[model samples]
Target: MARKAQTPDIGPFDRHSISLRVDHVRQLFQTLDPYPFTERDLDKDAEEFIVSWARELTGDGPIRIVIHLPAQEASSAEGRKLGNAVRRYFEERTRAVSLDLRECFRLGRLSLAIGASVLALCMLGAQALSQHSFPGSLQSFLTESLIILGWVANWRPMEILLYDWWPIARHRNLLRRLSVADVRIVAVSPDERSHPPH
Candidate 1:
Protein backbone atom coordinates (compact mmCIF):
# COMPACT_ATOMS: atom_id res chain seq x y z
CA MET A 1 0.00 0.00 0.00
CA ALA A 2 1.16 3.52 -0.78
CA ARG A 3 1.65 5.98 2.04
CA LYS A 4 -1.36 8.25 2.45
CA ALA A 5 -0.89 11.75 1.16
CA GLN A 6 -1.15 14.68 3.53
CA THR A 7 -4.58 16.33 3.47
CA PRO A 8 -4.36 19.63 1.62
CA ASP A 9 -5.56 22.72 3.43
CA ILE A 10 -9.10 22.50 2.12
CA GLY A 11 -10.49 24.85 4.70
CA PRO A 12 -14.08 25.45 5.82
CA PHE A 13 -15.48 22.25 4.46
CA ASP A 14 -19.26 21.87 4.70
CA ARG A 15 -19.98 18.71 6.68
CA HIS A 16 -21.87 17.33 3.67
CA SER A 17 -19.16 17.87 1.06
CA ILE A 18 -16.43 15.53 -0.25
CA SER A 19 -15.46 16.14 -3.85
CA LEU A 20 -13.62 14.41 -6.69
CA ARG A 21 -13.66 14.62 -10.51
CA VAL A 22 -12.87 12.59 -13.57
CA ASP A 23 -11.15 14.41 -16.42
CA HIS A 24 -12.85 12.45 -19.11
CA VAL A 25 -11.29 12.07 -22.53
CA ARG A 26 -14.06 10.79 -24.81
CA GLN A 27 -15.71 9.44 -21.64
CA LEU A 28 -12.67 7.93 -19.91
CA PHE A 29 -11.86 8.46 -16.23
CA GLN A 30 -9.05 10.91 -15.65
CA THR A 31 -6.85 11.95 -12.77
CA LEU A 32 -8.50 14.25 -10.23
CA ASP A 33 -5.22 15.09 -8.50
CA PRO A 34 -4.45 18.79 -8.43
CA TYR A 35 -0.80 18.57 -9.47
CA PRO A 36 2.70 17.11 -8.86
CA PHE A 37 1.40 13.58 -9.04
CA THR A 38 3.61 11.11 -10.89
CA GLU A 39 2.43 9.60 -14.19
CA ARG A 40 2.02 6.18 -12.66
CA ASP A 41 -1.62 5.38 -11.73
CA LEU A 42 -2.64 8.89 -10.76
CA ASP A 43 -6.34 8.17 -11.29
CA LYS A 44 -6.34 5.39 -8.70
CA ASP A 45 -4.21 7.44 -6.33
CA ALA A 46 -6.63 10.33 -6.43
CA GLU A 47 -9.54 7.96 -5.88
CA GLU A 48 -7.83 6.37 -2.93
CA PHE A 49 -7.22 9.82 -1.48
CA ILE A 50 -10.87 10.69 -1.83
CA VAL A 51 -12.09 7.42 -0.32
CA SER A 52 -9.55 7.65 2.51
CA TRP A 53 -10.69 11.13 3.38
CA ALA A 54 -14.30 10.09 3.20
CA ARG A 55 -13.66 7.26 5.62
CA GLU A 56 -11.66 9.54 7.88
CA LEU A 57 -14.59 11.91 8.22
CA THR A 58 -17.08 9.15 8.98
CA GLY A 59 -17.66 9.56 12.73
CA ASP A 60 -20.62 7.31 13.48
CA GLY A 61 -22.63 9.09 10.81
CA PRO A 62 -22.86 9.20 7.05
CA ILE A 63 -20.71 11.76 5.24
CA ARG A 64 -21.15 12.94 1.66
CA ILE A 65 -19.30 11.63 -1.42
CA VAL A 66 -19.13 13.94 -4.41
CA ILE A 67 -18.02 13.56 -7.99
CA HIS A 68 -17.60 16.72 -10.07
CA LEU A 69 -18.11 16.61 -13.80
CA PRO A 70 -19.41 18.74 -16.60
CA ALA A 71 -23.15 18.51 -17.20
CA GLN A 72 -22.60 16.82 -20.55
CA GLU A 73 -20.34 14.20 -19.07
CA ALA A 74 -23.19 12.14 -17.67
CA SER A 75 -25.29 12.48 -20.82
CA SER A 76 -22.79 11.39 -23.43
CA ALA A 77 -22.46 7.88 -24.82
CA GLU A 78 -18.85 7.88 -23.72
CA GLY A 79 -19.89 8.95 -20.25
CA ARG A 80 -22.25 6.01 -20.02
CA LYS A 81 -19.41 3.74 -21.05
CA LEU A 82 -17.21 5.18 -18.31
CA GLY A 83 -19.98 4.65 -15.77
CA ASN A 84 -20.27 1.00 -16.84
CA ALA A 85 -16.57 0.55 -16.39
CA VAL A 86 -16.72 1.92 -12.88
CA ARG A 87 -19.66 -0.31 -12.08
CA ARG A 88 -17.76 -3.36 -13.28
CA TYR A 89 -14.73 -2.52 -11.17
CA PHE A 90 -16.78 -2.36 -7.98
CA GLU A 91 -18.93 -5.33 -8.87
CA GLU A 92 -15.88 -7.45 -9.48
CA ARG A 93 -14.36 -6.47 -6.16
CA THR A 94 -17.53 -7.37 -4.27
CA ARG A 95 -17.96 -10.59 -6.20
CA ALA A 96 -14.42 -11.70 -5.49
CA VAL A 97 -15.13 -11.94 -1.77
CA SER A 98 -17.92 -14.43 -2.23
CA LEU A 99 -15.99 -16.43 -4.83
CA ASP A 100 -12.98 -16.73 -2.56
CA LEU A 101 -15.20 -17.60 0.37
CA ARG A 102 -16.74 -20.47 -1.58
CA GLU A 103 -13.32 -21.71 -2.60
CA CYS A 104 -12.18 -21.69 1.02
CA PHE A 105 -15.17 -23.71 2.11
CA ARG A 106 -14.59 -26.20 -0.68
CA LEU A 107 -10.96 -26.63 0.21
CA GLY A 108 -11.81 -26.99 3.89
CA ARG A 109 -14.35 -29.69 3.22
CA LEU A 110 -11.87 -31.55 1.01
CA SER A 111 -9.21 -31.44 3.71
CA LEU A 112 -11.58 -32.82 6.30
CA ALA A 113 -12.59 -35.68 4.02
CA ILE A 114 -9.00 -36.56 3.25
CA GLY A 115 -8.01 -36.43 6.91
CA ALA A 116 -10.85 -38.72 7.93
CA SER A 117 -10.02 -41.21 5.19
CA VAL A 118 -6.38 -41.28 6.18
CA LEU A 119 -7.27 -41.92 9.82
CA ALA A 120 -9.65 -44.72 8.89
CA LEU A 121 -7.03 -46.34 6.68
CA CYS A 122 -4.45 -46.16 9.47
CA MET A 123 -6.86 -47.85 11.89
CA LEU A 124 -7.60 -50.67 9.40
CA GLY A 125 -3.91 -51.16 8.68
CA ALA A 126 -3.04 -51.38 12.37
CA GLN A 127 -5.77 -53.94 13.00
CA ALA A 128 -4.76 -56.14 10.04
CA LEU A 129 -1.06 -56.03 10.96
CA SER A 130 -1.79 -56.87 14.62
CA GLN A 131 -1.84 -60.61 13.79
CA HIS A 132 1.63 -60.42 12.21
CA SER A 133 4.86 -59.92 14.15
CA PHE A 134 4.72 -56.12 13.70
CA PRO A 135 7.60 -54.54 15.60
CA GLY A 136 6.36 -52.30 18.40
CA SER A 137 8.64 -49.43 17.30
CA LEU A 138 7.49 -49.73 13.65
CA GLN A 139 3.83 -49.74 14.74
CA SER A 140 4.34 -46.62 16.81
CA PHE A 141 6.11 -44.91 13.92
CA LEU A 142 3.38 -45.76 11.44
CA THR A 143 0.64 -44.59 13.83
CA GLU A 144 2.43 -41.33 14.51
CA SER A 145 3.01 -40.74 10.80
CA LEU A 146 -0.65 -41.22 10.00
CA ILE A 147 -1.66 -38.92 12.84
CA ILE A 148 0.64 -36.18 11.55
CA LEU A 149 -0.58 -36.55 7.99
CA GLY A 150 -4.21 -36.49 9.15
CA TRP A 151 -3.61 -33.31 11.14
CA VAL A 152 -1.97 -31.61 8.19
CA ALA A 153 -4.94 -32.49 6.03
CA ASN A 154 -7.43 -31.17 8.58
CA TRP A 155 -5.59 -27.94 9.37
CA ARG A 156 -6.59 -25.96 6.32
CA PRO A 157 -10.29 -26.77 6.61
CA MET A 158 -10.27 -25.75 10.25
CA GLU A 159 -8.58 -22.46 9.49
CA ILE A 160 -10.83 -21.73 6.55
CA LEU A 161 -14.03 -22.71 8.28
CA LEU A 162 -13.19 -20.91 11.48
CA TYR A 163 -11.24 -17.76 10.61
CA ASP A 164 -10.37 -16.97 7.01
CA TRP A 165 -13.67 -15.34 6.01
CA TRP A 166 -13.75 -12.62 8.66
CA PRO A 167 -11.41 -10.23 6.90
CA ILE A 168 -13.09 -10.69 3.57
CA ALA A 169 -16.46 -10.10 5.18
CA ARG A 170 -15.21 -6.96 6.84
CA HIS A 171 -13.81 -5.63 3.58
CA ARG A 172 -17.01 -6.38 1.73
CA ASN A 173 -18.94 -4.63 4.46
CA LEU A 174 -16.79 -1.50 4.14
CA LEU A 175 -17.30 -1.42 0.42
CA ARG A 176 -21.00 -1.85 0.89
CA ARG A 177 -21.16 1.07 3.27
CA LEU A 178 -19.13 3.29 0.97
CA SER A 179 -21.27 2.36 -1.97
CA VAL A 180 -24.43 3.44 -0.17
CA ALA A 181 -23.14 6.84 0.88
CA ASP A 182 -24.84 10.03 -0.32
CA VAL A 183 -22.82 10.41 -3.52
CA ARG A 184 -23.53 13.53 -5.49
CA ILE A 185 -21.97 15.02 -8.60
CA VAL A 186 -21.50 18.78 -8.67
CA ALA A 187 -21.91 20.00 -12.19
CA VAL A 188 -19.03 22.08 -13.50
CA SER A 189 -20.49 25.21 -15.04
CA PRO A 190 -19.28 27.24 -18.05
CA ASP A 191 -16.94 29.36 -15.90
CA GLU A 192 -15.28 26.15 -14.54
CA ARG A 193 -16.85 26.42 -11.12
CA SER A 194 -18.57 23.48 -9.46
CA HIS A 195 -22.12 23.78 -8.15
CA PRO A 196 -25.11 21.57 -7.55
CA PRO A 197 -27.67 21.67 -10.30
CA HIS A 198 -30.82 23.72 -9.80
Candidate 2:
Protein backbone atom coordinates (compact mmCIF):
# COMPACT_ATOMS: atom_id res chain seq x y z
CA MET A 1 0.00 0.00 0.00
CA ALA A 2 1.14 3.51 -0.78
CA ARG A 3 1.62 5.97 2.03
CA LYS A 4 0.40 9.57 2.04
CA ALA A 5 3.12 12.20 1.91
CA GLN A 6 3.34 14.46 4.95
CA THR A 7 4.77 17.90 5.51
CA PRO A 8 8.03 17.82 7.48
CA ASP A 9 7.81 19.39 10.88
CA ILE A 10 9.38 22.85 10.75
CA GLY A 11 10.01 23.68 14.38
CA PRO A 12 8.94 23.41 17.99
CA PHE A 13 5.53 24.39 19.34
CA ASP A 14 6.40 28.07 19.49
CA ARG A 15 7.92 28.84 16.10
CA HIS A 16 6.33 27.71 12.86
CA SER A 17 8.04 27.95 9.48
CA ILE A 18 6.68 28.22 5.92
CA SER A 19 9.07 26.97 3.28
CA LEU A 20 9.22 27.77 -0.44
CA ARG A 21 11.62 26.61 -3.17
CA VAL A 22 12.19 28.50 -6.39
CA ASP A 23 14.84 28.63 -9.11
CA HIS A 24 15.33 32.36 -8.70
CA VAL A 25 14.42 34.97 -6.13
CA ARG A 26 12.72 36.99 -8.88
CA GLN A 27 10.13 34.26 -9.20
CA LEU A 28 8.88 35.31 -5.80
CA PHE A 29 8.01 38.84 -6.91
CA GLN A 30 6.08 40.63 -9.64
CA THR A 31 7.87 40.85 -12.99
CA LEU A 32 6.86 44.39 -13.94
CA ASP A 33 7.01 46.19 -10.62
CA PRO A 34 8.56 49.64 -11.08
CA TYR A 35 10.05 49.80 -7.60
CA PRO A 36 13.34 48.39 -6.29
CA PHE A 37 13.54 44.77 -5.17
CA THR A 38 12.95 45.52 -1.51
CA GLU A 39 9.72 47.45 -2.24
CA ARG A 40 8.31 45.21 -4.95
CA ASP A 41 5.08 43.26 -4.45
CA LEU A 42 5.24 39.50 -4.28
CA ASP A 43 3.96 37.51 -7.22
CA LYS A 44 0.30 36.48 -6.93
CA ASP A 45 0.99 32.75 -6.92
CA ALA A 46 3.88 33.06 -4.48
CA GLU A 47 1.91 35.29 -2.11
CA GLU A 48 -1.10 32.94 -2.10
CA PHE A 49 1.13 29.91 -1.49
CA ILE A 50 2.96 31.56 1.41
CA VAL A 51 -0.25 32.90 2.96
CA SER A 52 -1.97 29.50 2.69
CA TRP A 53 0.91 27.75 4.43
CA ALA A 54 1.21 30.42 7.05
CA ARG A 55 -2.47 29.97 7.90
CA GLU A 56 -1.97 26.22 8.51
CA LEU A 57 1.08 26.54 10.79
CA THR A 58 -0.36 27.27 14.22
CA GLY A 59 1.44 29.29 16.93
CA ASP A 60 1.39 32.56 18.85
CA GLY A 61 5.15 32.82 18.56
CA PRO A 62 7.06 34.20 15.62
CA ILE A 63 6.63 32.56 12.19
CA ARG A 64 9.49 31.97 9.72
CA ILE A 65 9.68 31.91 5.95
CA VAL A 66 12.43 29.73 4.52
CA ILE A 67 13.22 30.30 0.86
CA HIS A 68 15.25 27.52 -0.68
CA LEU A 69 17.18 28.22 -3.86
CA PRO A 70 20.16 26.92 -5.81
CA ALA A 71 23.44 27.55 -4.02
CA GLN A 72 24.53 30.05 -6.65
CA GLU A 73 21.32 32.07 -6.67
CA ALA A 74 20.94 31.75 -2.93
CA SER A 75 24.35 33.28 -2.43
CA SER A 76 23.68 36.13 -4.81
CA ALA A 77 22.98 39.69 -3.62
CA GLU A 78 19.29 39.23 -4.38
CA GLY A 79 19.08 36.40 -1.85
CA ARG A 80 20.63 38.60 0.78
CA LYS A 81 17.76 41.06 0.37
CA LEU A 82 15.03 38.47 -0.07
CA GLY A 83 14.03 38.53 3.57
CA ASN A 84 13.55 42.28 3.61
CA ALA A 85 11.61 42.15 0.36
CA VAL A 86 9.20 39.52 1.62
CA ARG A 87 8.67 41.37 4.87
CA ARG A 88 8.06 44.66 3.09
CA TYR A 89 5.57 43.06 0.72
CA PHE A 90 3.53 41.63 3.53
CA GLU A 91 3.66 44.88 5.45
CA GLU A 92 2.24 46.71 2.47
CA ARG A 93 -0.44 44.09 2.05
CA THR A 94 -1.37 44.41 5.70
CA ARG A 95 -1.80 48.13 5.34
CA ALA A 96 -3.87 47.72 2.21
CA VAL A 97 -6.15 45.20 3.87
CA SER A 98 -6.51 47.48 6.85
CA LEU A 99 -7.71 50.26 4.60
CA ASP A 100 -10.18 47.92 2.94
CA LEU A 101 -11.54 46.90 6.32
CA ARG A 102 -11.95 50.49 7.39
CA GLU A 103 -13.79 51.31 4.18
CA CYS A 104 -16.06 48.35 4.71
CA PHE A 105 -17.02 49.61 8.14
CA ARG A 106 -17.56 53.10 6.86
CA LEU A 107 -19.92 51.83 4.22
CA GLY A 108 -21.72 49.76 6.78
CA ARG A 109 -22.32 52.75 8.98
CA LEU A 110 -23.65 54.85 6.13
CA SER A 111 -25.92 52.08 4.97
CA LEU A 112 -27.25 51.65 8.47
CA ALA A 113 -28.18 55.33 8.72
CA ILE A 114 -30.01 55.21 5.42
CA GLY A 115 -31.73 51.98 6.33
CA ALA A 116 -32.87 53.36 9.68
CA SER A 117 -34.32 56.46 8.10
CA VAL A 118 -36.20 54.37 5.59
CA LEU A 119 -37.54 52.10 8.31
CA ALA A 120 -38.71 55.06 10.36
CA LEU A 121 -40.53 56.55 7.40
CA CYS A 122 -42.14 53.22 6.65
CA MET A 123 -43.33 52.79 10.24
CA LEU A 124 -44.72 56.34 10.28
CA GLY A 125 -46.55 55.77 7.03
CA ALA A 126 -48.01 52.53 8.34
CA GLN A 127 -49.12 54.29 11.53
CA ALA A 128 -50.74 57.13 9.60
CA LEU A 129 -52.63 54.69 7.37
CA SER A 130 -53.96 52.87 10.47
CA GLN A 131 -55.58 56.11 11.79
CA HIS A 132 -57.41 56.61 8.47
CA SER A 133 -59.62 53.52 9.08
CA PHE A 134 -59.65 52.40 5.45
CA PRO A 135 -61.49 49.19 4.46
CA GLY A 136 -60.28 46.35 6.77
CA SER A 137 -58.65 44.26 4.03
CA LEU A 138 -56.88 47.21 2.38
CA GLN A 139 -55.54 48.49 5.71
CA SER A 140 -54.08 45.11 6.64
CA PHE A 141 -52.37 44.73 3.30
CA LEU A 142 -50.81 48.22 3.39
CA THR A 143 -49.59 47.85 6.96
CA GLU A 144 -47.97 44.50 6.31
CA SER A 145 -46.37 45.69 3.08
CA LEU A 146 -44.86 48.76 4.76
CA ILE A 147 -43.41 46.65 7.59
CA ILE A 148 -41.89 44.19 5.16
CA LEU A 149 -40.40 46.95 3.04
CA GLY A 150 -38.90 48.59 6.10
CA TRP A 151 -37.11 45.40 7.09
CA VAL A 152 -36.08 44.75 3.54
CA ALA A 153 -34.53 48.19 3.34
CA ASN A 154 -32.26 47.17 6.22
CA TRP A 155 -31.05 44.05 4.45
CA ARG A 156 -27.89 45.59 2.98
CA PRO A 157 -26.78 47.18 6.23
CA MET A 158 -27.39 43.98 8.12
CA GLU A 159 -25.43 41.99 5.56
CA ILE A 160 -22.52 44.40 5.64
CA LEU A 161 -22.36 44.60 9.41
CA LEU A 162 -22.78 40.89 9.99
CA TYR A 163 -21.17 39.05 7.13
CA ASP A 164 -19.12 41.09 4.63
CA TRP A 165 -16.62 42.60 7.04
CA TRP A 166 -15.67 39.37 8.74
CA PRO A 167 -13.62 37.95 5.88
CA ILE A 168 -11.90 41.27 5.35
CA ALA A 169 -10.94 41.49 9.01
CA ARG A 170 -9.63 37.95 8.95
CA HIS A 171 -7.56 38.67 5.85
CA ARG A 172 -6.11 41.79 7.44
CA ASN A 173 -5.11 39.85 10.51
CA LEU A 174 -3.40 37.21 8.41
CA LEU A 175 -1.46 39.86 6.52
CA ARG A 176 -0.44 41.47 9.78
CA ARG A 177 0.92 38.14 11.01
CA LEU A 178 2.82 37.58 7.78
CA SER A 179 4.27 41.08 7.87
CA VAL A 180 6.00 40.35 11.18
CA ALA A 181 7.08 36.81 10.36
CA ASP A 182 10.79 35.99 10.35
CA VAL A 183 12.26 35.23 6.93
CA ARG A 184 15.28 33.08 6.01
CA ILE A 185 17.02 32.06 2.79
CA VAL A 186 18.44 28.56 2.39
CA ALA A 187 20.91 27.39 -0.24
CA VAL A 188 20.12 24.14 -2.08
CA SER A 189 22.06 22.10 -4.61
CA PRO A 190 21.21 22.37 -8.35
CA ASP A 191 20.08 18.74 -8.36
CA GLU A 192 17.57 19.20 -5.56
CA ARG A 193 13.92 19.43 -6.50
CA SER A 194 12.29 22.74 -5.65
CA HIS A 195 9.82 21.16 -3.29
CA PRO A 196 9.11 21.70 0.41
CA PRO A 197 10.84 19.16 2.58
CA HIS A 198 8.72 16.08 3.30
Candidate 3:
Protein backbone atom coordinates (compact mmCIF):
# COMPACT_ATOMS: atom_id res chain seq x y z
CA MET A 1 0.00 0.00 0.00
CA ALA A 2 1.18 3.51 -0.70
CA ARG A 3 1.98 5.61 2.35
CA LYS A 4 -0.09 8.66 3.09
CA ALA A 5 1.32 11.80 1.51
CA GLN A 6 2.93 14.25 3.89
CA THR A 7 1.21 17.59 4.34
CA PRO A 8 1.92 19.91 1.41
CA ASP A 9 3.10 23.52 1.69
CA ILE A 10 2.44 24.65 -1.83
CA GLY A 11 0.62 27.83 -0.88
CA PRO A 12 -0.57 29.97 2.02
CA PHE A 13 -3.24 27.41 2.94
CA ASP A 14 -2.42 23.83 3.94
CA ARG A 15 -3.19 20.79 1.79
CA HIS A 16 -4.57 17.65 3.47
CA SER A 17 -4.47 14.28 1.73
CA ILE A 18 -6.61 11.27 2.63
CA SER A 19 -5.23 8.02 1.27
CA LEU A 20 -6.55 4.46 0.79
CA ARG A 21 -5.36 1.33 -0.92
CA VAL A 22 -7.46 -1.18 -2.85
CA ASP A 23 -6.73 -4.00 -5.25
CA HIS A 24 -8.71 -2.34 -8.02
CA VAL A 25 -10.32 1.03 -8.70
CA ARG A 26 -13.67 -0.75 -8.90
CA GLN A 27 -13.44 -1.55 -5.18
CA LEU A 28 -14.00 2.11 -4.47
CA PHE A 29 -17.40 2.15 -6.15
CA GLN A 30 -20.72 0.41 -5.53
CA THR A 31 -20.89 -2.77 -7.56
CA LEU A 32 -24.68 -2.86 -7.56
CA ASP A 33 -25.02 0.53 -9.20
CA PRO A 34 -26.08 0.19 -12.82
CA TYR A 35 -25.19 3.78 -13.66
CA PRO A 36 -22.21 4.60 -15.82
CA PHE A 37 -18.86 5.13 -14.11
CA THR A 38 -18.92 8.89 -13.64
CA GLU A 39 -22.46 8.84 -12.23
CA ARG A 40 -22.22 5.76 -9.99
CA ASP A 41 -22.47 5.95 -6.22
CA LEU A 42 -19.47 5.08 -4.09
CA ASP A 43 -19.54 1.83 -2.13
CA LYS A 44 -21.14 2.34 1.26
CA ASP A 45 -18.10 1.24 3.26
CA ALA A 46 -15.82 3.31 1.07
CA GLU A 47 -17.98 6.38 1.41
CA GLU A 48 -18.24 5.98 5.18
CA PHE A 49 -14.47 5.55 5.50
CA ILE A 50 -13.75 8.63 3.43
CA VAL A 51 -16.30 10.82 5.18
CA SER A 52 -15.15 9.72 8.63
CA TRP A 53 -11.59 10.70 7.79
CA ALA A 54 -12.79 14.01 6.35
CA ARG A 55 -14.67 14.83 9.55
CA GLU A 56 -11.47 14.33 11.53
CA LEU A 57 -9.59 16.76 9.32
CA THR A 58 -9.02 20.28 10.69
CA GLY A 59 -8.14 23.68 9.26
CA ASP A 60 -9.38 25.39 6.07
CA GLY A 61 -6.82 23.52 4.04
CA PRO A 62 -7.53 22.23 0.56
CA ILE A 63 -8.39 18.50 0.58
CA ARG A 64 -7.11 15.77 -1.74
CA ILE A 65 -8.00 12.09 -1.91
CA VAL A 66 -5.34 9.59 -2.97
CA ILE A 67 -6.28 6.07 -3.93
CA HIS A 68 -3.59 3.43 -4.40
CA LEU A 69 -4.37 0.61 -6.82
CA PRO A 70 -2.45 -2.19 -8.49
CA ALA A 71 -0.34 -0.91 -11.35
CA GLN A 72 -2.32 -2.82 -13.99
CA GLU A 73 -5.68 -1.59 -12.73
CA ALA A 74 -4.41 1.89 -12.01
CA SER A 75 -3.42 2.36 -15.64
CA SER A 76 -6.74 1.11 -17.00
CA ALA A 77 -9.66 3.13 -18.39
CA GLU A 78 -11.70 2.59 -15.21
CA GLY A 79 -8.98 4.21 -13.14
CA ARG A 80 -9.06 7.24 -15.40
CA LYS A 81 -12.70 7.71 -14.50
CA LEU A 82 -12.21 7.16 -10.76
CA GLY A 83 -11.70 10.80 -9.89
CA ASN A 84 -14.77 11.94 -11.76
CA ALA A 85 -16.85 9.17 -10.22
CA VAL A 86 -15.78 10.12 -6.72
CA ARG A 87 -16.51 13.78 -7.32
CA ARG A 88 -19.92 13.04 -8.78
CA TYR A 89 -20.83 10.80 -5.87
CA PHE A 90 -19.95 13.45 -3.33
CA GLU A 91 -21.72 16.10 -5.38
CA GLU A 92 -24.88 14.02 -5.23
CA ARG A 93 -24.43 13.61 -1.49
CA THR A 94 -23.99 17.35 -1.08
CA ARG A 95 -27.24 17.99 -2.92
CA ALA A 96 -29.07 15.43 -0.81
CA VAL A 97 -27.77 16.93 2.42
CA SER A 98 -28.76 20.37 1.24
CA LEU A 99 -32.30 19.10 0.80
CA ASP A 100 -32.21 17.65 4.30
CA LEU A 101 -31.08 20.96 5.73
CA ARG A 102 -33.78 22.82 3.85
CA GLU A 103 -36.44 20.41 5.05
CA CYS A 104 -35.16 20.72 8.61
CA PHE A 105 -35.48 24.48 8.48
CA ARG A 106 -38.94 24.23 7.00
CA LEU A 107 -40.09 21.95 9.80
CA GLY A 108 -38.45 24.22 12.33
CA ARG A 109 -40.34 27.22 11.00
CA LEU A 110 -43.65 25.41 11.03
CA SER A 111 -43.09 24.07 14.52
CA LEU A 112 -42.09 27.49 15.75
CA ALA A 113 -45.31 28.97 14.47
CA ILE A 114 -47.40 26.29 16.10
CA GLY A 115 -45.44 26.48 19.33
CA ALA A 116 -45.81 30.26 19.54
CA SER A 117 -49.53 30.09 18.95
CA VAL A 118 -49.95 27.40 21.62
CA LEU A 119 -47.82 29.38 24.03
CA ALA A 120 -49.90 32.48 23.45
CA LEU A 121 -53.09 30.59 24.11
CA CYS A 122 -51.69 28.95 27.22
CA MET A 123 -50.49 32.29 28.60
CA LEU A 124 -53.90 33.79 28.00
CA GLY A 125 -55.59 30.87 29.70
CA ALA A 126 -53.25 31.17 32.70
CA GLN A 127 -53.84 34.91 32.91
CA ALA A 128 -57.62 34.46 32.77
CA LEU A 129 -57.48 31.82 35.49
CA SER A 130 -55.43 34.12 37.73
CA GLN A 131 -58.28 36.64 37.76
CA HIS A 132 -61.07 34.08 38.47
CA SER A 133 -62.04 33.03 41.97
CA PHE A 134 -61.07 29.48 42.85
CA PRO A 135 -59.45 27.47 45.69
CA GLY A 136 -55.94 28.83 46.28
CA SER A 137 -54.13 25.49 45.74
CA LEU A 138 -56.18 24.54 42.64
CA GLN A 139 -55.67 27.96 41.04
CA SER A 140 -51.95 27.84 41.66
CA PHE A 141 -51.68 24.33 40.20
CA LEU A 142 -53.65 25.21 37.07
CA THR A 143 -51.62 28.40 36.42
CA GLU A 144 -48.31 26.61 36.84
CA SER A 145 -49.41 23.72 34.63
CA LEU A 146 -50.44 26.07 31.85
CA ILE A 147 -47.09 27.84 31.94
CA ILE A 148 -45.19 24.57 31.91
CA LEU A 149 -47.27 23.20 29.07
CA GLY A 150 -46.65 26.33 27.06
CA TRP A 151 -42.91 25.99 27.41
CA VAL A 152 -43.13 22.30 26.60
CA ALA A 153 -44.96 23.09 23.39
CA ASN A 154 -41.86 25.00 22.25
CA TRP A 155 -39.44 22.15 22.96
CA ARG A 156 -39.43 20.61 19.46
CA PRO A 157 -38.98 23.89 17.60
CA MET A 158 -36.24 25.04 19.93
CA GLU A 159 -34.43 21.73 19.56
CA ILE A 160 -34.77 21.82 15.80
CA LEU A 161 -33.60 25.43 15.43
CA LEU A 162 -30.87 25.38 18.06
CA TYR A 163 -29.35 21.88 17.87
CA ASP A 164 -30.68 19.52 15.19
CA TRP A 165 -29.72 21.64 12.21
CA TRP A 166 -26.07 22.00 13.14
CA PRO A 167 -24.89 18.48 12.27
CA ILE A 168 -26.91 18.41 9.05
CA ALA A 169 -25.46 21.74 7.96
CA ARG A 170 -21.98 20.63 8.91
CA HIS A 171 -22.38 17.38 6.97
CA ARG A 172 -23.57 19.32 3.91
CA ASN A 173 -20.50 21.53 4.14
CA LEU A 174 -18.23 18.50 4.44
CA LEU A 175 -19.74 16.83 1.38
CA ARG A 176 -19.37 20.08 -0.56
CA ARG A 177 -15.69 20.19 0.28
CA LEU A 178 -15.25 16.59 -0.77
CA SER A 179 -17.18 17.13 -3.99
CA VAL A 180 -14.47 19.53 -5.16
CA ALA A 181 -11.51 17.68 -3.64
CA ASP A 182 -8.62 16.78 -5.91
CA VAL A 183 -8.40 13.03 -6.50
CA ARG A 184 -5.17 11.23 -7.49
CA ILE A 185 -4.60 7.56 -8.25
CA VAL A 186 -1.22 6.02 -7.40
CA ALA A 187 0.03 2.82 -8.98
CA VAL A 188 1.33 0.20 -6.59
CA SER A 189 2.91 -3.25 -7.02
CA PRO A 190 0.53 -6.25 -7.00
CA ASP A 191 2.02 -7.47 -3.73
CA GLU A 192 1.38 -4.13 -2.03
CA ARG A 193 -2.14 -4.02 -3.39
CA SER A 194 -2.90 -7.53 -2.07
CA HIS A 195 -1.81 -6.61 1.42
CA PRO A 196 -3.09 -3.05 1.83
CA PRO A 197 -2.08 -1.27 5.01
CA HIS A 198 -4.55 -1.59 7.89
Error of 1 at 95 (Å): 3.4
Candidate 3 residue pairs in clash (backbone atoms < 3 Å) = none
lDDT of 1 by residue, 21-95 (tens): 554422223445343222212245644764566556644355445555676875556444443444444455557
lDDT of 2 at 130: 88
**C-alpha RMSD (angstroms) for model 1:** 8.4
- Estimate candidate 1's alpha-carbon lDDT, on a 0 to 1 scale: 0.54
> Candidate 2 deviates by what RMSD?
3.9
Task: For candidate 3, give the lDDT of residue 49.
Answer: 83
User: Native-vs-model 2 lDDT?
Assistant: 0.82
lDDT of each: 0.54, 0.82, 0.84
Task: List CA RMSD, all candidates.
Answer: 8.4, 3.9, 2.8
Residues 14-33, candidate 3: write the lDDT tens digits.
44668877777777787888
lDDT of 3: 0.84
